[model samples]
Every structure is written in C-alpha cells, then in structure tokens.
Target: MISVYIGMGSNLDGPVAQLEQAILTLTNHTELHNIAVSPIYSSKPVGPQDQPDYANAVMRLDTKLSAIALLDLLQSVEQEQRRVRDRHWGPRTLDLDILLYGDELIDTPRLSVPHPYMLERGFVIQPLNDLSPELMLANGRRVQEHLSQLDTSDLVIIKEV
Candidate 1:
C-alpha cells in the first residue's frame, strides 16, 4: 500500500457537512485504508474575498491504487457532493487535492502530487501538521517546521477530528 495525504475544503452548501460526508465516503471506499484526519480549520477565501470562509482539513490514507486512480476517486467524491467548478477558486461544495503521494514526486496533466501550493497555504499545512507533525514533503521540509512560519492567524480550529 502507498501512503497519501489529501487536502479537503468546502465553502458552500454547509461546508462542514460537505467535508464530513466526503470523509465518510473516503473511509468507506474499498481502495483506501488506514485513514486518518486532522482538525478542521476555517479560513478566508484564498482567491476571492466575496465568498464565505472555507472549512478545510487534511487526511492521510493508505491505498493500493495508483496516484491517478486516487485522484479520480477524490474528484468523484467532490462531484457526488455537488462540487461545481463554475469559476477558478471561486466557491464550491467540495474541493479535494492530493497533497502528497508517499514520498514520490509526480507532475502530470491530470494531477500533481505534493500539490503546488500546499507549502504556502496555512490552511493546508496547519491541519497537515496535526495529522503528521514529523511528515516531510518531497522538498524535505517537515510539516511542523513549515507551519511555524505561516500566518495562520486567520486559521481557526472549527472542528477536531
């Protein structure tokens, strides 16, 4: 099995409930195992200020599926949760991204492991730190160390998982 870290977010249609449902879906899926989650955080919108704040968290799981297959699974969960990609970083019922696929580096037209923006996003790193404080990204930075320098002043613990 390969270990993977995934980021989850929602800002529309009851953000917390959306995340909860998606988590349930993932944990119940046959391909994923040894699942773990972090406390949820509420943060301001990353791209636009007009939308409501987002509910976000990070999840770690072991899976036998390939990285692309896992990405397909996440996208399916998002769609099931009514995720509408009407605008870029606009608003959605759910958004899931693969933050890391084990320690392997990957970049493809369909997906990218070690998600490009994860290091800079406090919402991502904070919960990620909670789940795996000793976790290191492909770039060699520990989750805790990277989180220490972020301005997570806006990230509030909305729920503990």
Candidate 2:
C-alpha cells in the first residue's frame, strides 16, 4: 500500500460538518486503511477575500490504488458532497487535494503531487504540521522548518471540530 496525504477544506454549507463528514467518508472507504487526520484549522480564504473563512485539515492514509485512481475516488467524494467548480478558488462545499503521494513526483495534466502551492499556504501547512512535524517535503525542508517560514498568525485551531 502507498502512503498518501490529502488536504481537505470547506467554506460552504457548514464547513466544519462538511469537513468532518468527508473525513468519515475517507475513513470508511474500503480501499483505504490506517487513516489519520489532523486537527482542523480556520483560516482566511486563499482566493477571494469576500468568501467565508475556510475550515481546513489534512489526512494521511494507506491505499492500494494508483495516484490517478485515488484522485478519482477523492473527486467522487467531493461530487457526492455537492462540490462545485463555478469559479477558481471559489467557495466550495468540499475541496480535496492530493498533497503528497508517497514521495512520488507526479506531473500529469490532471494532477500534481506535493501540491504546487502547499508550502506557501498557511491553511495547508499548519494542519499538515500537526500531523507530521518532522515530515520532509520534496523540497528538502522539514515540515516544521517550512511551516515556520510562513506567517500562520491567521490560522486558528478549531478544537473539538
């Protein structure tokens, strides 16, 4: 099985509940195992500031499927939760991204591993740090070191979320 990290966020239709439910869905998936999730964080929208703040978290799981196959499953989960792509970085019921895929460097037209913008996004960095502080990103920086370089003052841990 391949170890993978998935980033999940929501800003519409009860963001917290949406996130919690998505985690449950991933946990229940038959093909996934040893699932672990980070504490959710609340942060300003990464795109248009006009939208509601986002609830974000990161998940780690072991899967027997290929990257593309896992992406398909994640997209299906988003669609099942009514995610819409009406606008770039727009409000979404659920937005799931493949942050890392077992240290693989994937660059397909449909996906990119180590998520292109992850290192710079507080919403992604903070929660990811919560799960694996010592994790070494593909860029050769420890997760803790990378997280420290970013301004995470705006990130608020949503305890018991």
Candidate 3:
C-alpha cells in the first residue's frame, strides 16, 4: 500500500455532516485502509463569495489503488454525496482531491499530484501539517515549511473528527 493524502471540503447540504459521511465512506472502502483524519476546519470560500464557508479536512489513507483509480473512487464518493460541478470551485455537498499520492509527481490531463496549489492554500496546508509536519513534498520541501509561508487567517478549527 502507498500513502495518500486527500483534501476534502464541503459547503452545501450541511457541510460538517457531508465531510463526516465522506470520511466514513472512505474508511469503509475495501481498497483504502488505515485511514487517519485531521481536525475539521472552517474556512472562507476560495471561489465566489456568494457561497457559504466550507468545512475542510485532510485524510491520510494507505491504499492499494493506483492514482487514477483513487481519483475515480473519490469522484464517486462526491457523486454519492450529491456533488455538482456546474461552477468552478463552486458549492458542493462534497469535494475530494488527491492532494499527494506517495512521493510521486504526476501531471496529467486528468490529475496532478502535490495538488499544484497546495503550497499556496492554507486550507490544505494546515490540516496536512497537522497530519505530518515533517512530510516532504515531491520537490523535497517540508510540509511545515510551506505551511509557515501561508497566511492562515481565514482558517479556524471546528473540532477533531
């Protein structure tokens, strides 16, 4: 199994419950095991301000699935949670992103590992730091190093899972 870090967020249809249920679904998946989740955080929306704030968290999973296959599973989970992608970074019942897939750096039409913008997004960095502060990115930078450069003023801890 490989280590995978996933970023989960929700702003619609009871954001907290949506996140909780999504985590539960991941834990129940046969291919995904040893799931560890960080504390839930409430953050201002990254896109249109018209939508509500999002509840976000990071999940660490040991998985036997390939990166693309894992992406498919996450999308399915979003669909099951009634996610709609009508708008970019729009409000959704659930949003799951493959933040880091082991130490591999992948850039394909469908997926990007290290999440491209993770270093700039406090919502992703904060919880990721909570999970593994010493984690090194594909490029070799430490998780806490990137996190320290971000402005986390918009993020607030809701509670542990």
Candidate 4:
C-alpha cells in the first residue's frame, strides 16, 4: 500500500457536514485503508470572497490503488456530494484533491502531486501539519516548515478529528 495525503474542502450546503460525509465515503472505500484525518479549519475563500468561508482538512490514507485511480475515486466522492465546478475556486459542496502521493512527483494533465499550491495555502498547510508535521513534500520541504512560513491569520480550527 502507498501512503497518500488528500485535501478536503467545502463551503456550500453545510460545509462541516459535507466534509464529514466525504470522510466517511473515503474511509469506507474498499481500496483505501488506515485512514487518518486532521482537524477541520475554517478559512476565507481562495477566490471570490463573496462566498462563505471554507471548511478544510487533510486526510492520510494507505491505499492499493494507483494515483490516477485514487484521483478518480476522489472525484466520484465529490460528484456524489453534488459538487459543481461552474467557476474556478468557486464555492462547492465538496473538493477533494490528492495533495501528495508518497514521495512521488507527478504532473499529468489530469493530476498534479504535491497539490501545486499546498505550500502557499494556509488552508492546506495548517491541517496538513496537524496530521503530519514531519511530512516531507515531493519538493523536499517539511510540512511544518511550510506551515511556519504561511500567514495563518485567516485560518481557525473549527473541529478536531
């Protein structure tokens, strides 16, 4: 099994409930095991501040599925949660992203490992640090190191997992 970190977020249709149900869906997946979830954090929306703040967390999973397959599974969960991708970084019911896949560096049309902007986003870094402070990204920076550099003034821990 390979270790994978997934970032979860929602800002619509009850963000907390959306995240909780998504976690259940991931934990119940047949190919995913040894699930670990971080505390949920509330943060300002990344774009279009008109929307509600987002509830976000990071999840760790040991899985037998390939990276693309895992991405597919995540997308399915989002769809089940009624995710609508009508606008970039717009509010949604769910957003599941593969933040890291072990130590692998992947950049394909369908996915990008290390999540492209995990280091720069406090929403991703804060909860990620809660789960694995020592985790080294594919780019070699430690999770806590990234957390320390980010301005988390807009983040608030809403719930502990």
Which candidate leads the pack in lDDT? 3
For model 1, the local distance difference test gives 0.92
Q: Write the per-residue lDDT of candidate 4 for residues 27-125, one digit (tens) a residue.
A: 888899999999999999987988999999999999989999999989999999999999998989999999989888899999988689888899998
Alpha-carbon runs more than 4 Å astray in model 4: none
lDDT of 2 at 100: 96
Higher-ranked by lDDT: 3 or 4:
3
TM-score: model 3 vs. ground truth: 0.97
The TM-score values for the models, in the order shown, are 0.98, 0.97, 0.97, 0.97
- Our model 2 lands, by Cα RMSD against the true structure, at 0.9
All candidates' lDDT scores?
Answer: 0.92, 0.92, 0.93, 0.91
What lDDT is reached at residue 142 by model 3? 96
- At residue 96, candidate 3 shows an lDDT of 95
Candidate 2: segments with Cα more than 4 A from true spot: none
Model 1 CA deviation exceeding 4 Å by range: none
Per residue, candidate 2 scores C-alpha lDDT tens digits across 1-161 of: 89899999999999999999999999999999999998888999987888999999999999999999999999999999999999999999999999999999999999999799999898898888888999988889899998889999998889453
In terms of lDDT, model 4 sits at 0.91
